[model samples]
Target: MKYIKEFEKKMNLGSDNQLANGHVEQASIPKENEGSVQTYVQLLKPERFYMFLEILIYCIVGHFIGYLIAPILKNYFYNNLEWY
Candidate 1:
């Protein structure tokens, strides 16, 4: 029984060491925006600036209207309120 327990413990330790090594290897590679600075900066160009801004503004406006209406409708419905 003691030998079996020791053998299992050794296998568990080996698996844990392998997982740690795998994580270390994964961390050594460049990730997302951390890799290249210029590539991310180039994404914001003059030609696409207005287009991006326009889409952003539209999304913001839609969100704002939805925010304002959602609460009011929710409250009205919960309170069973209606008007002619």
Candidate 2:
């Protein structure tokens, strides 16, 4: 029990130290102006374009699947219809 408490105390201290260091580093960084076009361009990485292409391909595939399945679903539902 004592050993577990000590271990937890050490872990807590380590996390606090890390948090303090992060705050210091964050304070040291210069604030970027929000209106900078250069910063905006830099933020638009090539990975974003690749992600967009991936999403677009998935959307097109989904549309094609839905189109192919629609007729089958419609026929099944129509055939299974019961008189009210």
Candidate 3:
């Protein structure tokens, strides 16, 4: 029990690095899961929200392109003559 608490405290202290402009580094506090249902949510600060959205859009577009290309290529080969 004692060792676990120390480990957790060290992990929670991860954002204490210094910035070049003398700002204390900080990040979102972790949230706890709801009982039994296994669902939880984090309220993102604005900067984090913007970064999240940017990454989300990139992932969505990348997956969409992959999904579109998969069927088109499959059909192109399936429809082509074996000699070609």
Candidate 4:
């Protein structure tokens, strides 16, 4: 119990009472227009485009790999493996 208390004190877990007593600082709220959807859309416009391009490339590459490997595996299994 003493070790747990010491660990909590080391980790600042016992500061909840201090926080409740107004030692905690609050985050400033953004203005109504600052946090609008239009602002977020503007911020994320390029990122969204890049994300879509990345997903499309990944899907194309995955399909290419699957198609390239499927026939090779099928040929190898049919030619080399014997099922009794």
State in Å the error of residue 29, model 3. 12
**lDDT of every model, 2 decimals:** 0.63, 0.66, 0.62, 0.70
- How do all models score by TM-score? 0.36, 0.47, 0.39, 0.43
- Among these predictions, the greatest TM-score belongs to 2
The sequence of per-residue lDDT tens digits that candidate 1 reaches over residues 1-84 is: 677557657656334323522222222223575667665564445657889989999999999999999999999897896665
Candidate 4 structure quality by residue, lDDT tens digits, 1-84: 798777667767554333422343433334776867775654454766999999999999999999999999999999999899
lDDT of 2: 0.66
Q: Once superposed on the true structure, which residue ranges of model 4 sit more than 4 Å away at CA?
A: 1-44
- Which 10-residue window in model 1 sums to the lowest lDDT? 20-29
- Which model, 2 or 3, shows the larger lDDT? 2
Ranked by TM-score, top first? 2, 4, 3, 1
Highest lDDT scorer: 4
The best-first sequence of candidates by lDDT reads: 4, 2, 1, 3
- As for candidate 2, its clashing pairs are none
lDDT of 3 by residue, 6-72 (tens): 6656655324453434344653333453342323232324677889999999999999999999999
Candidate 2 stretches with Cα past 4 Å from truth are 1-44
> What CA root-mean-square deviation does each model show from the true structure?
13.5, 9.0, 11.9, 10.1
